[model samples]
Target: MTDVMRCEAVADIATPIGHAGRVSSPVAEFDPKRVRRLRRYTWWSVVPMASFYAILVITGLVNGFADGTYAAADLLVLGLVLLVLTVEATRFCASTMRGLGQGRHHGAEQAAAFIAALLTAGCVLATKPEYGFIWVLLPAILAASIVTNATVSLRWPLTFATCGSTAFVVATASWRYGPPMVPIRFALIAAAVVAFTIFVLVVAVWFWDVVLELDRARSVSAELAIAQERLRFAAELHDVQGHHLQAIALKGELAERLVGADDGAARAQAAEVAELARTALRDTREIVHGYRRSDLATELDNAREILEAAGIATTVSGHARSVAPPLQPLFGALVREGATNVLRHSRALHCEMSILTDEHGSEVVLRNDGVYASDGTSGSGIDGLRERFATLGGQVRAEHRDGWFELVGRAEEPGRSEA
Candidate 1:
């Protein structure tokens, strides 16, 4: 939001008197729709880990119930431990997915981990001797998941220590309380479960991180493009005005020196200075005019590049020259504004621009498939286009129909006689 506001403020300062009321720069607004879509993607990526964790919790509870050797007190203790692990796991996952700068709730996470570990020890002590290390699987898996959420510098070492300790505890408990043959096998199984759980949790966190990085990169790329455009305009203005201003300055000095000494020479130099000034003024106007005039073919090509960069497929049809020359600029503005809307306003997957012309009039239609909803308001850019087209006996309209958002503009052929 600060970046956008800064750009808008600069634009306001730079705008000419005639353009003061024009629509704001397309890049000046942040796209909440795109942000929300990315957020949804982030949440969905975390679902697999969450679902697997839930399934394991349920399985543990069911297994304890089926093992009838456990008394009511033991079962109650196991349930409470599972509940604490579940709450901690939830906190860890939330903190990891929210990314950096948001609070990680380290105190709560530490408390949960401590409580879970203590409860696991209780379960280990209370379970029947024959059951051995079976009750430890749930807490072991939960602990590994929580540990993997550690900062990058400590994640792997912490995970390894957690896994090794879990295995050793399970092995010792089995040897001390279970059938003699089960210790080594149960230890290996415990290690495998913890390793696999950590792997899944790690992959899910990595996926979420990648999505966030991509989003940040996209924003940086847009801001860079805006900066480059400003530089280009500045360079062109400097190029156009620099030579003329220099020559005018030299001529004015000559005219000043010649005065009272050579009246005729002074008048000639003054005329030259005036001519240079007029030429500079004219050239500056031309440069500004060319800058403001949008060309249909150039805009179409640009739109294709931008949409493709954003992962949206783009198709542009119909020749630029086929549109009446007078209407080309209008259609070009439509294309540019349409592209901006498609990107910022919708989760568009595909975009199509079609230019159509005949003896009667010219038309350009932009279509995109990601229309979620439309409240029938076309926004300031489209509203401005509508007013411009209306002055020329043409019309521009935005419509949402048949799962597509369409911006259509039509204008009569210039110089065509009325019947």
Candidate 2:
């Protein structure tokens, strides 16, 4: 009964929006971390009243059992009151934890409050001589109302019922076949009861309102983060494509004009168009990837060194330097991929790479002298390589034949017509 509300973090532990006031079970739809935290908050919330009630009952029980004037009958009455309390307390707890729903179930909350108040009054009245002043149970029951959401509507009937029940308990005790306690004692108990009921219910409902507000704040924060990302994407896109598109339009107009007048010059302008397209594609990729961080020569050198250290003789001959600047990443990927295959699917003594360039195209042939039947298909890296090379009229292929594994690839000159 000496417990005061330590509401420092009560709002933080109140039900969040997702599982607020509508879960079918205690263990359902609740975050384990949050649930654990809520459980503690709930303990703190109820212990003050519940623990105080327990001490009051025990005081009544012991005082009754000690006095010879009220041994057997008062013991049986208090025992019956305990049974009713056990059932009502369980109901009250379930209602409190789940959060009493709104108007849809207002009747249940009313019934609970009225019945609990009557039972609490009965416990005190049962030991009238021993249980003095604890008649405050009547008003306490009225004030300890619960709600799942922050909505309170005062009903005149419920107010009448609670007040009437308190009066009935005090009147019955005063008018009973004995010298009654003074009138001031009844007034004090009635005043304490009414004051606590109002205080407890108001504070309890306000805590949950704060919880609902916090949930809304979290939702706003997430939406703001998403808006910031979209703005960044838009700004980067404008910066990358603005000048490139203007240059592409000029080159296209030049090619169109030359097509009728000078065929050779038009062909040259078309090649410039292909180069411009490649540059735009690269710019877009860089924006998405955060920046172009790989160079084919560097990757090839790293791959060759890695494979050689693994006790495999590696001969890398791909002239990544000969490929157009935009396509170097694809050749670099081929070198890295060849090294990975040698290490993972083959116990190879030798790995060889041949970079061949001709008038039509550039090809990288990666061959290793070990064959292990494997489920490793062209995985994400190879699929990405295929897409990247396809943008510039190129492709990659793989084969296994007689203890030899070969991956061969080519990216044709950009302006070359596919035959």
Candidate 3:
């Protein structure tokens, strides 16, 4: 629930109601109750405006009565007109809310709201002969809604234009009525226009900043993933290649010692050396191929060959066929990294490779029983392997205890083995 609340808040802030004329909110934050509340508030906007109209009617009645010209029939008619305008305003707000929440026809709702406000203003102006001061209520309510919403979409533009036109009409009507402060009223209208323009510019800048921030975040995430992949690749190369070279060097020295005493023995040892060299070449090619990162099965085969050439027994078991292609490289990378670690660090007589696949994707494990050095430092190989797996949204763990070492890598989904 807390996560949901946070997501809603982010969505509400990010979604822009720009010049597209659509009332688009962040889909993430949309809830039926929120829509209902918007509708309630929109309709509730009519209350203050209607109250002003009531005051106008009451004042008119009081003025007429003071001059002995007031009639109960005239007051009743004025009250009825106010009631009709209030209902229209309520309907317009309700429709706007429905459009906003349902992702329906927003443009139509905005048009309706504009039209209603304009008609109400025009009505007030037309009736100013009977209730002279009543005309002020329309522009006051328009300005209030504009300030309260803080929104500058199509509706706002329409609002600004409507209010400006209403001001022009009011000013003209006042001049005709010989009002003493007509010029002051025109000056206030000019100020409202300037303020609304400034509001529009501010909203545009805010929207641009939001888009830029989102792009920056995505770029940072991508860079981090690439860095992790590079590390894992380095670790894998160190582990696999390091052990193979060490064994070849050791075998060459042994062959040199037996060469002079017995020709046959010397030749046999030479053959072993030759075989080891061939195996090493094959393993190196496979590792390079892993830089391209082939399927899981291919990597498994290479791992087995590398282990066996190092005189370490290896066993692989489980269904190897159903793994998805996208995940193949990740699995292969895991196998390559694991085998390299075993050869360089484990010194185990036997190593086991097992793969299991079910509904959850796939799992690969490598374990060996060998002499694991207790030195509490990992070489560049292990560090590189860790970084690689992390890029693919996977993890690697190395454990050593009782002369056994285990390296495990698992990925949520397969990715390219090469960084």
- Superposed model 2: Cα runs more than 4 Å off: 1-42, 69-77, 90-106, 109-113, 119-129, 132-135, 147-150, 155-188, 201-205, 208-212, 215-223, 238-250, 292-419
Model 3 clash pairs are 228-387, 231-384, 232-384, 232-385, 232-388, 235-381, 235-384, 327-414
Off by over 4 Å in 3: 1-4, 8-76, 95-130, 138-153, 179-419
Q: Residue 184 deviation, candidate 3, in Å?
A: 5.0
Using lDDT, rank the candidates from best to worst. Answer: 1, 2, 3
| TM-score winner | 1
Which is superior by lDDT, 1 or 2?
Answer: 1
TM-score of 2: 0.49
Task: Specify the highest-lDDT model's number.
Answer: 1
lDDT of 3: 0.53
By TM-score, highest first, what's the ranking? 1, 2, 3
- TM-score comparison, 1 vs 2, better candidate: 1
Candidates in order have lDDT scores of 0.65, 0.57, 0.53
Candidate 2 clash pair list: 143-197
User: How big is the positional error of residue 267 in model 3, measured in Å on the Cα after superposition?
Assistant: 45
Q: How many residue pairs clash in each candidate?
A: 0, 1, 8
